[model samples]
Target: MRLALFQMTSGIDAASNGDAIAAAMDVAADGGADALLTPEMSLLLDRDRERAAVRAEADYPEIAVLRKNARELNLWLHLGLPVKQGDKRRNRTLVIAPNGEIAARYDKIHLFDVDLATGESWRESRVYEGGDAPVLVEMDEQEVGLSICYDIRFPALYRTLAEAGAGLLTIPAAFTVPTGRAHWHVLARARAIETGCFVAAPAQVGRHEDGRETFGHSVVIDPWGRTLLDMEQGRGVGFADIDFAAVARARVQVPALANARPIPSPVRRGMAAQAN
Candidate 1:
């Protein structure tokens, strides 16, 4: 299947951002993408949830427009954690089926709350509550796992998804410039390697009007942890065709699942003293 990852740079205005997403969908369609994905905050980028609250109102025009556009285009679109949720904005992903109906919704499990040494700080929990469930969607005759930006850092989560029989994992991210530069590619590759599944990461790039900058470089990795497509920094589309056969092929060769062994490797509390 041909998949497209939109490397977008989000703006502060929700309406304009929505329009950009629509346009990107068109580009992906023109490029013959079977499925398309956008970065996190696909509609708006703001640290203020108080303002984002307005997006949830039933009359909010942007959501309707997005739904209408998705239905019209006949594209299976994945909008990554759009800001325009509801009274309580969930860092959520909306899967728009070809019929225009919302096929599934996945709220981000791991919030991006962090304090870094470079004077960079994020308090996502203050605005958005984290989601706890894992979402698996039907796609390309296989199950696809859903995850967000910060969730990629957790290895156990991906392992669980793989155990659940997910062949593809999608991570739509608006990674900060600092973390993205340092760990984006490595983490994406690691997730694919551990899970033995194909990974598609659509990302945000460039500086946002809110004074926040994102690391671009959207990536797609095959089951064996090789990059199939890499979108260089900035606004654009990256494409890669996944060979379903390869998914099984890689797993059989690695035999990671059959070989996985779980044994206690960490320090023991009282056991260390008993040795003395």
Candidate 2:
């Protein structure tokens, strides 16, 4: 499958971000991409809660426009956006098929709540509710796992998806520069290697209207931990060709998933006396 990853520098303006995403879809379609994956918060990235809520509430209109575009272009679009759910919002991904139907929706199960050494702090749980389950969907004859930015840190989720027959994983993110530089590539590659699944991480890059900087290396890693495409610091769409055969080969060569066995609870043992 041919995939296009959109590395965006989304800002406080919802309309502007929507326009950018729509334009990228056109580019991806014209380039003969089977699907376009966008970064997290592709619709609006704002630190201010009040402003963000107002802007995010208006997302349905933008989604309608995007759906129309998807239908017209006959392109599949996997978009990351903030969705208003009852009294709170959820960081969600919507996979729209070529026919403009919503094929799948996955809310982010992990929230980023950290106090960084760089004096940057984020409390994602403050405004968003966490999802309860992992989502796997069929697309282009392959099973795809859905996850968002902070979800990459949790290996259990990836393992569950992999065990559930997912051959491809999508990790769309808006990562802080500090964490991104330290763990982004390592975590992505680790998940791919562990699960024997192709990893596609479309990321948000550069300074935003909200005064935060993000690490911008949107990457795609093969099951063997090979970096297929890395759009380092550039803000646009990057393309990669995925071979499902690689997934099969990697799994067969490693056989870790097949060899996996449940571990029993640890039993405490008395410590032996140390020799003087």
Candidate 3:
């Protein structure tokens, strides 16, 4: 399948963001893309809690447009992360089928709560509630697993998805500049190598309306951990051709997933005493 990953800067206006998304989807479809993927907070990116809450009400207009575009263009789409309306919002990703129906939804499982030496502090949990379960979907005979930004730090989740027959993993993010510089590429490559799954990461780049900056190097990696496409700070669509056969080849060569074993807990390993 041909996938187009969009790396764009989204701001506070949901309507404006939706317009941009529509334009991107149109371009992707014209480029012979079977599917189009976007970054986190595709609808709106803002740090002002009060404004965000007020702007992102329960009526998600952006998702509606996405579904319509998917059906009209007969193309699959992954709306990376949108704020779902609730008393407390949920950071959610939606997989839309060509028929404009939602195939799967995965809420972000890990909240980004960190304090950086650059004097940047983020408390995602303050506004968004984390999801409790992982999500996997089958698209055109390919099993795809879903995740968000902060979840990349947790390898077990990727392992579980791969074990469940996911050959492709999607991690859409709006990563901070510091963390992205320090760990983005390495972490993404590690996830692909460890799981033997194709990694497609569409990310946000540049400055947002809230005066927040994101590191944008959206990448697509093969199952063997080879870079297929990398959007390095460019603000546009990045395309990559996906081969299902490559996934099988990599898994067969390594066979790491099949040779898995159970390990003792920290307590059994005598690490519990160290904590005390």
- Taking the tens digit of each residue's C-alpha lDDT, what string does model 1 give over 1-276? 889898888776778887888888888888998888998877777775555433553554776787787777777888865444433457888888877777888989887777899988788776677787999988756788999899999988888888889889999998888788899999999999888899999988888777788888899999999999889795877789998788789889887865878867886669676886
For candidate 2, lDDT tens digit of each residue in 1-276?
Answer: 999999999998878998999999999998889999999988888888977744354446888899899999988899888878888889999999989989999999998898877787889899899999999989978999999999999999999999999999999999888888899999999999999999999999999998999998999999999999999999999999999999999999999899999999886556633422
Pairs clashing within candidate 2: none
lDDT of each: 0.82, 0.92, 0.89
| Two-way lDDT contest, 1 vs 2, winner | 2
Ranking according to lDDT, highest score first = 2, 3, 1
- Number of the top TM-score candidate: 2
Q: Give stretches of model 3 more than 4 Å off.
A: 53-58, 266-276
Error of 1 at 222 (Å): 0.5
Query: Lowest summed lDDT over 10 consecutive residues: which window, candidate 1?
Result: 51-60
Which candidate has the top score in lDDT? 2
- The positional error of residue 271 in candidate 3, measured at the CA in angstroms, is 12
